[model samples]
Every structure is written in C-alpha cells, then in structure tokens.
Target chain A: MNILAYIIQKEFIQIIRNKAILPMMTVLPIVQLIVLSNAASNEVKNVNVVVVDMDQSESSRTLNHKIIANDRITLVATSFNTNEAHFYLQENTSDIVIEIPPDFENDYINGKQPKIQLLVNATNGQQAIVGSGYLKAIVASFNAKLIQKVIPDISISKQSNTTISSRYWYNPELKYTHFMAPGILAQLTALLTIILSAMNVVREREVGTIEQINVTPLKKWQFILGKLIPFLCIGLVLFTVGIIASKLIFSIPILGNLPLLFGYTTLNIIAVLGLGLLISNFADTQQQAIFVAFFFIIIFVLMSGLFTPIDSMPKWAQQLTVGNPLAHFISVSRKVLMKGSGFWNIRFEFLYTFILAFIFNGLAVWSYKKQV
Target chain B: MNTPIAIELDKLTKRFGDFIAVDAITFKVKKGEIFGFLGANGAGKTTAIKMLIGLSKPTEGMGKVAGFNVDTEPEKIKKNIGYMSQKFSLYDDLTVVENIQFYGGIYGLSREKIKEKTTEILEELELTEVSKSLVISLPLGWKQRLAFAISMVHDPEIVFLDEPTGGVDPRVRRQFWETIYQVAEKGRTVFVTTHYMDEAEYCDRVSIMVAGKIEALDTPHNLKQQFEATSMDEVFLKLAR
Candidate 1:
C-alpha cells in the first residue's frame, strides 16, 4: 500500500509539474464543452434550404412562405431552374431544396393533389431522415390549409369531433441542452480517461523511468493499480466538472442521486482507463500510443449512440453496441440527469458496467509484463 | 570472508522459441566483487543479466539471487538488487532531489532515512547547487551519475548496470568506474555489463561471452595470458574467432 501511494504521488507530481498537461487537463475540457455544446444540438433547426419556384403562382408562393415561417427551413435564396437548385445542392450550400412544379395552381384548382418535390441532401443520413419527417409535417399542414381554402366541401363532410393532448415524459420543455449535457458527460469521461491514463504510462516509457520502476520490489498488479488510481481521480474530477457545467452553465437539472451517479461513473472509468492501458501496451512509441488511442476512441464514441439513438440501429449494430461501455454510461447519465432514475432503475446498467470494467482491466494487466 | 555469495546460478539457460539467448551458462559473483559481464552486441549478455535480476524467466535452469529463488521469488530478488539501464533512467522532468525522494520512497525508506540519504547522496555528487533543478537541465555525465546513485539509494546487496557508460566521454566513464569501485569497497557486489575492453580491465574478474556462451572467465590479466594477448581488447579479438 505504501509503495502504491508512492507511485500515485509521483504520477501526481509529474502531472502537476508539467505546465503543458495542467491546461490540457483543466482548461481544454471547459473550452470543448462551451464550443461543442452549442454546435451539437440533436434537433436540426434552421436548415439552409433552397427554393426553386418553377410555378410563379400565388399558391406556390404561399407554400414557400409557410415553409419559411415554420422556422425549421430557411430559404436562403430562390433558384429559377432545376439546374440552379442542382448546383446549390451539389455544392452543399443548401441542405434541402423545395421545388414547386409548373401548373401547380391548375392542378389544385382542378381538384387534383398537386405533386411537389423535396430534394434532400442525404449526406448526413440521420439528419436527412429527421429533417424529411419535419418537412413532411410542414407540407402536410400546408396541404390541409390548401384543401380547406380551395376545396372546403371535401374537408369537413367526413370529419368527426375528437380531442387529443400529449405530455413529454422527461424534458417537459424539450430543451436541446437537457438532452445534450448528460450525453456530453459520457463523452468527457471517455476522452479524459483514455488520454490521461495512456499518457501516464507512455510518458514513463518514453522517458525511461519505467525501467527504474521495474527494478523495484513493486508487484505488477500494484504498479498497475497504482497508476490507475490517479487516473480514476482525474476521471472523478472530469465528472464533477461535467455535472457543474450541466447544472450551472447549461442550467440542466441533475435529478438523480449524485453519489450513485459517481459510483457508477467510477466503475465505467475503469474500463476506459483499461482501454488506454491496452493501447499503451500495444504501442512502443508515444506517437503510436496516441494514434491507437485515437482510433479506438473514434470507434467507441461513434458506436456509443451519443449522436443518435441506439434503438434505431439495426439488430446487428445494436448487438455490437451492447459491448460498448460508453453506450451504457451515456444511458446511465441520461437516466440520472433527465429522468431522475434511482439505484433500482439503473441497477442493471451499473452491474453490467462493473463486470465489463473488471474484465477489461484484467485483460490489460494480463497483457503487460516486465519484459522489454 | 563470512559474506555469502550474492549471486549463484547453475545450468541457467534462456531460449526464445528454440533460439538460445543464454546457453546453459553457469557462474557466480561473491559479495563485494566488481564482476564484469562482457560481450559483443547480441551475445546474450543482456539476456543473462535480465534472468539473474528476475526481469526475465529462464527457459531451463536453477538460480538464486540474494538467497531468493529466481523462479518463485523474483520480487524478493528485486528488493535486494538495484538496476541502472544504459538509457539513464531518472525522470528528466523531475528535479534531482525529487527523483531521489521518489525512488527512496518507493523502496520503502522511512522519511527520516530518506531525508538523510537525500542530503548525503546529493552532497556526494557535489550537486547541491543544482539538486532542485530539473534533470533535463543537467549534463549527460551528471545524469548518468545521478542514475547510478539512485540505483544504490536503497543500499541493496547488489547493483546491476547494463552498459552504464555506453555514450559518455572517457573522463565520465572513468568517474563512473570510480563510483563502482567505491560501491564495491563498501562490500556491495557490482555486477556490470559493458563492451569496452579497457573498462573490462577494471573488473576484479571478467567473463567474455561470444555466441551466447561464456568463452573465457577469469581476471583480466589471466584471460590475457590465456589468450596470448597483452590487453583485454586483443583477448576479445582472439576469443571472438
């Protein structure tokens, strides 16, 4: 235990003494939080949309005005022809294009549903899907209004009186910040844990201090656990910062128990730090270490369902995400922050994370040896 | 006379998937001896040293270091031996005193003992003025010497130096050897490996390894006479054949 303390102390000293690491640890996270949170809204609003008004009729003009007033689509410019709209779409200047076909006024007046076209950029496939749903709703509303004005006799003849009301289970206001801040906590955990823990080992290897430690009476398990404890502390600090940023900066509520949140977060960090150590063991050079860490981090974060809902993924993809610890933590964070879930509600995820953390950390220690 | 042998081995061999790195070589070093383990690059000198120090396991052999079995009690062997590598293993980001205190603390030295040893080791190196300076600011020679001092901070029964003076100037090399001699004078075994034939002469006894086998083991003078050469360098050229 004393030897472990010494190792932890040395690690802390190195982290504090190096002026470069201090800002990277404390300042960079805050800066990333501020910049990325604003840019990371799940609700895609204010889509830059282009209009190709082939029909100069008043009805087409009214349809375009409805789209603009809905605030989901912004008509940056009006294109005269399909060629011009094609250029805007190809150049990525517009996320979507609304084309009003010629003779659209004749078709509506003749009691035929006018056919309109929505040219969507599927470059960001998920956003395109969501944006299409949004656009369809707006167009549907416009079509209803058109039918009421142009053909009122067909509208109310078959209608029956009914009442409908809805309530959101969590995030009653549906603020984007409430949804995002908790997910950001998971991202911060993975980023800080992997980078910090890998750096801890790789720096010693680069500087040749590893040989000094290897010669000591220190057990491999002791040394590994000793290294992990400091990073665990660092993870805790990052988690605290994330919580503060959510409550104070974003004004999101933390409705669950703080201690349970911390307890589960600690278990999740073990897996993250273990991944970092595994990367360190594979890389002989620090550059290689950072690269391996980066590659894994990208895969982990993308598959973690941070930017999209895991439920929408295909069965095979969802099965693969089951193995991703970050996905579980993200769910835990959302449950705790948004829904105010208690220990009983989060018990399964907590237990899963604990076992995964144990297995990953065990493999990491198993791969490491005293040999050169 | 009563001090037991610090290192003992019999039929110690290490193999890497059928390639013999150290081929069943047997040797022993008594307490308070400056034993030189000499070899060319890839001649298995490092592999042998690693096995003895418990950093590696022998494929087939029996060995004991500081009375601990190499196979079962490697950690106990670690507690009794100090190791310094060719790369100068002090943390360049840490100050001289910080480095010393860290190693001493990990070695389980009492705070009072660490304080006394820190001052003694610093003053002995005549580095009091720069003890608080980062090791990166120190010269190469100073770093090597500080590394050596740290290896001995726990007062182990034996100190193993693998190519300790590989890249230093001759003057610094000579000073490093003087420290080895001082360490041996204090009755601690100094087991060192080097390629410098001239430095081999400084060993109380030297063993020459060629092709993973010990070709000659004796005092430098006797090995020279046996090889019909006047110096250890020519003796190596002869045995290398």
Candidate 2:
C-alpha cells in the first residue's frame, strides 16, 4: 500500500510536470462542449421558399400570403413562371418552390379540385422534409378556412370522428441541446480517461522508467492500481467540469440524484481505466497503444447511443450496446439529467457498469505480466 | 576466508521459440566481490541479468539471488537487491531530491530514513547545490551518478549494474568505478556488466560471454597469463575470436 501511494504520487507529479497534457485535460472538454453542443443541432429553421403564381387569383394570393406569414418559411423570390422559380432552386437560393396553375381560383370556386405542384430540394433530406411539413400545414388550414366560408353552419371539427394529440415526454420543448449535452459529457469523460490511462504505461515503457519499477518489489496489483487511481481521479475531475458546463453553459437540468450519478461515474471510470491498462499491457509502444485506443474509442462512441437512440437500432447493434460501458453511462446520464430517474430506475445500469468494471479490471490485472 | 555466495546459477537457460538467448550456464559470485559480466551486444548479458533480477523468468534453470530462489522467491530477491539498467531509469521529470524520495519510499523506507538518506546521498555526490533541480537539467555524468546512488538507496545486499557507465568521459568513468569499489568494500556484492575492457580490469573477477555462453571466467591477472595477452582487451579479443 505504501509503495502504491509512492507510485500514485510519482504519476501525479509527472502529470503536472507535463506542460502539454495538463492543459489539454482541462481545456479540451470545455472547448468541445461549447463548440460541439451548439454545432450539433437538428432543428431546421428559416427555409428559403420561391413561389410561382400563374393564376394571380384571390385563392392563389391567399395561399402565398399564408406561406409568407409562416415564421419558418422565408419568401426569397416571387416568379410568374416555373422556369424562373427553377432557376432560383438550381442556384440554391431557394429550398422549396410552389407553383399554382392558371384558373386555380375559378376551379376551386366551381367545386373542381385544382392541382398545385411543390418542388423541394432533396439534397438536405431533413430540411426538405421539415420545409414540406410547414407547406402542408398552411394548405390544410387554408382548406379549412375555405370550408368554413362555404358552409357557415357546418362544423369542421364535427366532420372528424377521431382526434389524436401527440405529447413528448422527458423533454417537453424537445430542445436538441438538452438531449445532447449529457450524452456529450459522458462521451468526453470516457474518451479522456481511456486515452490518458492507456498511453501512460506504454509511455513509461518507452522512456525506460517501467523497467525500474518492474525490478522493484511492487506487486502487480499495487502497480496497476496506483496507475489507475490517478486516472480515475482525473476522470472524476473531468466529469465535474462537464457537469458544470452542462448546467451553466447549456442549462441542462439535473433532475435525478447527484450522488447516484457520481457513483455510476466512479464505476465507469474504473471500467475505462481498466480498459486502458489492458491496452497498455498488450501494446509495446506508445504509438501502438494510441492506435488501438483510437480504434476502440471510436467504436464505443458510435455504438454508445449518444447521438442515436438504441431502440431505433437493429437487434444486433442493440445487443452490442449492452456490452458497451459508454452506452450504459450515456443512458444513465440522459435518464438522470433529463427524466429525473432515481436509483431504482438506473439500478440495472449501475449493476451492468459495476460488472463491466470488474471484468475489464480483472482482465487487465491478469494480462499484466510482472516477469517475462 | 570463506565468503558466502551472494548469487548462484546452475545451468540457467532461456529460449525464445527456437532461438536460445541464454544457454545453460553455471556460475557463482562470493559476497563483497566485484564480479564483472562482459559481453558483446546481444551476447545475452542483459537476458541473464534480467533473470537474476526477477524481471525475466528462465525457461529452465535453478538460481539464487541473495539467498532467495529466482524462480519462486522473486519478490524476496527484488527486496534484497538493487538494479540499475543500461538505460537511465530515473524519472527525468522529477528533481534529484524527488527521485530519491520516491525510490526510497517504494523501498518501504520511513519518512525520516528517506530524509536522512537524501541528505547523505546529495552531500556525498556533491549535488547539494542542485538537489532541487530537475534531473533532466543535470549533466549526463551527474545523472549517471545520481541514478547509481538512487539504486543503492535501499542498501540492498547485492547491487546489479548493467553498463552503468556507457557514454561518460574517461574521467567520469574512473569516478564511477571509485563509487563501485566503495560499495564493494562495504561487503555488498557488486554484479556489473560492461563493454569497456579497461573497466573489466577494475573488477576483482571477470566472466567473458560469447554467443550466449561464458567463454572465460577468471581474475584479470590470471586470465591475462592464461590467454597470453597483456591487457584485458586483448584477452577479450582472443576469447571472442
């Protein structure tokens, strides 16, 4: 135990002495939080629209006014011919184009259904889908108004037998930042801890310091633990920084228990640090350790259900996510922060993370050879 | 006088697949003796030292380091020995004092003991003025001496030095041998490996290794007489050829 303490002290001193890594640990997360959180937005707004009105009638003008009044649609150009509107669409000046045929108002007034054409730029699929939804809502409301004028006594609501109201739970406003902040924090914590710890042992080997340590009377477990404890502390410190950024910068609320979050974070750090040590044991050089860590971290982050919902993934992928510690932590972070989930709600995640911690750390210690 | 054996090896061998790094060899070193291990690069001096120091296991052998079995009591052997590798193993980022304190601490030395020894080592090396400076800032000769001193901080029964003075000037090399002689005079066994033939003459006894086997083992004077060579360097060339 005394030897372990000395090792930890030496490791901490070396970390502080390294001018490059110390600032990187403290600054990288903050920069990533500020930059990635704001940049990773799914909400599409201010879609440019071009209208080609050949009818020039009351109904067509009314439709045009409705499209213009909608906040999300911006009327960049008004054209009398489809050719001119096509030019705007081709130039990328407009995301959507609406064309109303001649005699549209007369046909509608005479009880004839007139056709209208909507051309949406499908290059950006999400923006095109959302822009089309706004156009549909405006046209539907216009149809409802027309029906009301034609029959004053007939009720449009009574015409529909069924009504469906959709409610979004956990996030009432569906703010992308709120959903993403916790996930990003979890990913950053895992990435930093895994990479730092993974590179540490191999770096010692490259510098020949490990030979000195190996010749000492320090036990394998003590040495591995000494290496892991410092990184675990750093992981927690990074976690705290991430939490502050999430709450202060992003306004992500923490509705669940704070202590429970920390408990899971501790377990997650153990698992990741163990994984790092395992990599160090297998890698003979710092470069090899880094490449191996990079490969695993990329896979862990992508399959961790950080950006995508696991439920939406295929069965095989969901099964793989069950083994990923990042996935478990992300689930816990999102649930506890967004949905106010308590210990009992996240008990399975805690259990799984703890088991993974044991497995990874056990494998690391077992694979680490004191003598070759 | 019958000085007890500090290190013994009976047919120690190591094999990596089909290639044999250290062939079966037997030897013994008495306590308070300077035993020089001389070998060319990749002649298996390092592999043999690693096995003795508990850093590597022998494929087939029986050995004892400081009365502890190298195969079973490696931890005990580690506790009873000090090792300095060919590469400077002290943390260059740490100060001279910090490195001493850290190595002393890992050896299970108390705070007061570490403090007392730190002062002694610093004053002995005449590094008291720059004790607080980072080890990397020190000159190579100073770093080498500091590393040697730190290895002996635990005051083990046997000290193993693998090419401890490889790249220093002749003056520094002579000074290093003075320190080794001092430690040997204190009745601690010194097991050292060196490529320099003049350094081999400084040892009380020398073993020349060739192609993973000991080609010659005797005192410098007797080996010179037996090989019809005037100096240890000529003796080494004759054995290697």
Candidate 3:
C-alpha cells in the first residue's frame, strides 16, 4: 500500500510537472462542451423556400404569407411559374419549392379539396424531412383557418370537440443541445481517460523507466492500480467539471440524482481506463498506443448512440452497441439527467458497466507481464 | 577467509528460436567483489544481466541471485538486488529527492528511513542545493551518479550497474569507478557490464564475452598475462578478433 502511494505520488508529480497536460485536462473539455454541444445539433432552422403561386388567388397568397410567417422557413422568392421555382430548387438556392395549383377560390368556397405540390431537396435527407414537416404543419393550420372562414360554426365545434395535444415529457422545447450536451460530456471523459492512460504506460516503456519499476519488488496488480488511481481521480475531476459546465453554460438540468450520476461515472471511467491499459500493455511505443486508442475511441463514440438514436440503427449495429460502455453511459446520462430516472431505471446500465469494468480491467492486469 | 557466494550460475542458457542469446555459461561471485561483465555490442551481456535481475527468464539453466533461485524465486531475488540500466532510467520529470524517495519507498523503506536516506544521499552527492530540481535539469554525469545512488538506496546485497558510465567525461567516469570501489569495500557485491576495457581493469575480476559465450574470466592482470597482451584493451581485441 505504501509503495502504491509512492507510485501514485510520483505519477501525480509527473502529471503536474507536464505543462501541456494541465491545460488540456482543465480547459479542453470546457471548450469542447461549449463548442461541440451547440455545433453538433441537427435542428434545422431558416430553411430557404421558393413559392410558386399559380392560382393568383387571395387564399393562395394567404397560404404563401403563412409559409413566410413561420420562423423555421425563409421564403427566398415568390414566382408565378413552376419552371422558375424548379430552377431555384435546382440551383441549390432553395431547399423547398412549394407550388399551389391554379384553383379558383370558387372551388375552395364550394368545399372542393385542392391539391398542392412540394418539392424538397432530398440531398440532405434529414433537412429535407424536417422542412417538409414544417411545410405540412403550416398548410394544415391554414386549411383549418379556411374552414373557419367558410363554415364558422362547424369549424368551431369540430375544433372544440376533438384535439390531440403532445406534451414532450422531459424537454418541452425539444432543444437538441439539451440532448447532446450530456452525451458529449460522456464522450469527452472517455476519450481523455482512455488516451491519457493508454499513452502513459507506453511512454514509460519508451523512456526506460518501466525497466526501473520492473526490477523492483512491486507486484503487477499494485503497479496497475497505482497507475490507474491517479488517472481515475483526474477522470472524475474532469467529469465533475464537465457536469458543472453542462449545468451552468448549457443550462442543462441535473434532475435525477447527482450521486447516482457520479457513481455510474466511476464505473464508466474504470471501463475506459482498463481498455486503455490493455492497449498500452500491447503497445511498445507511444505512437502505436495513440493510434490504437484513436481507432477504438472513434468506433466507441460513433456507435455510442450519441449523435443518432440507437433504436433507428440497424439490428446488427444495435446488438453491437450492447458491448459499448460509452453507449451504456450515454444512455444513463440522458435518462438520469433529462428524464429524472431513478436507480432502478438505470440498474441494467450500472450492472453492464460494472461487468465491463471488471472484464476490461482484469484483462489489462492479466496482459501486463511482471516478468517482462 | 571464506567470503560467501553472492551469485551462482550453472549452465545458464537463453535461446531465442535458433539464436542463443546467452549460452551455457557458469560463474560465481564472492560477497564483496566488483565483478566486471565485458562484452561487445550484441554479445548477450544484457540478456544475462536481465535474467539475473529477474527481468527475463533463462530458457534453460539454473541460477541464483542473492541465494534465491532465478527461475522460481525471481521476486525474492528482486527484493535482494538493485539494477541500473544503460539508459539513465530515473524519472526526469521528478525532482532528485522525489526520485530517491520513490525508490526507497518501492524497496519498502519506512517513511522516516527514506527521509534520512534522502538527506544522506543528497549531501553525499553534494547535490543538496539541487535536490529539489527536476532530474532533467541536471548534467549527464550528475544524473548517472544519482541513478547509481538510487539503485543502492535500498542497500541490497548486490547492485547491478549496466553501462552506468556510458557517455560521461573521463574525469566523471573515474569518479564513478571510485564510487564502485567504495561500494565494494562496504562488503556489497557489484555486478557491472561495461564496453570500456579500462573500466574492466578496475574490476577485481572480469569476464569477456563473445557471441553469447564467456570466452575468458579472470583478473585483469591474469587475463593480460594469459592473452600475452600489455593492457586489458589489447586482451579484449585479441579475444574479440
């Protein structure tokens, strides 16, 4: 135990003495939180639209005005010809082209349903989908208004009798930043802990200090524990700072339980650090360690369901995520922080992460050869 | 006078696939002798030292370090000996005192004992002024001497120095030899490997290795007489050629 303390102390001293690591630990996460959370959002805003109104009717103009009034879409041009609007869409100047067929106001007054065509740029499939949804909402509301003008009593009674209201449970606004911030926090902690621990042991080998330690009477498990403890502390400190940044800077709420978040974070960090040590054990140089760590971290982050919904993923990919510690941690963070989930809600995540921590750390210790 | 045997090797051999890094070589060292291990590059001096220091396992042989079996009792051997590598292996980011304290702690020295030893070491090396300075800031010779001191901080029965004075100035090299002699006089065995033949002359007895085999083992004077050479360097060249 005393020797372990000495090793930890030496590691801390080395870390503190290294000028580059301090700022990286403290400042880089905050910067990533501030920049990546906002930047990583998929929410579409100010979508450019071109409207072709061939009807030349008051109702058609009113529909065009409604589309323009909706803050999500920007009406870049109003044209009478479909060809011109198609040209704008083809030129990539417009994301959506709306065409109202030439229908007399008489047909609308006579309760004849008129059809409209919408051409969306599907190149950016997600943006196009969201833009088309907004367009549908605007047209639906405008159709209800036309009914109110045409038949006041029927429209009022129909609206009063039946309504379907959606209440977004956790995030009423559906702000993507609120969803992304916690996952980004998980990603940053995992990346930093894995990379730092991975590079550390290999660096010792390269510098020949490993030979010095190997010659000593230090046990293999003791050496691994000593190396892991300091980084674990650092990882936790970085995670706490990330949480604070999430709450203060991003206005993300910490709703469920702070202690629960911390508990799961500990398990998550152990799993990542263990995998890092495993990589370091196999690597002979710092460069090889970094490259191998980079590869794993990239795969872990992408498959972690941070940016995309896991349910929407292919079946095989979803099955693979069951083994990803980051996936489990990100789920726990979102559920606990946003949904106010309790321990029982995240018990499976905790169990899986604990098991991952055990297997990975055990493999790392086993792979580290005391003899060599 | 019967000085107890500190190290014993009987047919210690290490083979890597088809190549024998350390062939079946046998030797022994007395309790307080400076035993020089002389070899050219790739002559397997390091492989042999590694096996003795419990860093590598011998493929086929029997050996004991500090009276502990090299094969089955390496951990016990580790506790009884110290090692300094060819490269200065001290943590450059740590201070001189911290490095010494760390080694002392790893060797299971008490806190108070480490404190006392730290002071004695810094003062003995005349590095008390620079004890708090990072090791990388020190000169190469100072680093080498500090490394040697740290290896001996535990006061083990045997201290292994592998090319401890590789690149230092001639004056520093002579000072390092004086320290080795002082250490041997204190009744602790010194097992050292060096490329310098003159340094071999400083050893009480020396072994010259060629192609993973010990070609000759004797005192420098006897080796000179036996090889019909005037100096240790000529003896080494004659044997190497």
- Against the true structure, whose DockQ is highest? 2
Runs in model 1 with CA error above 4 Å?
A: A47-61, A76-114, A117-121, A130-135, A150-159, B1-3
Report the Cα lDDT for residue A48, model 2.
95
Across B86-203, the per-residue lDDT of candidate 1 in tens digits comes to 8879988789999999899889988898999999999999999999999999999999999999998999999999999988899999999999999999999999999898999999
The TM-score leader among the candidates is: 3
Docking class of 1: medium
Candidate 3 regions with alpha-carbon error over 4 angstroms: A80-87, A103-114, A147-161
Clashing pairs in 2: none
In candidate 1, position B138 carries an lDDT of 97
| First chain TM-score for all predictions | 0.89, 0.90, 0.94
DockQ of all candidates, in order? 0.64, 0.80, 0.78
Ranking by TM-score: 3, 2, 1
Give the worst 10-residue stretch by lDDT in candidate 1 chain B: B1-10
> Candidate 3 at residue B227, lDDT?
94
Ranking by lDDT: 3, 2, 1
Query: Mind giving the per-residue lDDT tens digits that candidate 3 earns over A129-197?
Result: 999999999999998898888888773565466778899979988988899999998998988999999
Model 2, span A1-372: residue lDDT tens: 777888899889988888977667668888888887878776787799999999999889999999999888899999998888999999999999999899988888787888888999989888899989889889988987876776667755765746679999888888888988898899999988998998999988899988998888878899899999999988988889889977888799798888989988999999999999999999999899999999999989889987667898899999988789999999999999999899999998988888889999999999988799
What is the RMSD of candidate 2?
Answer: 2.5
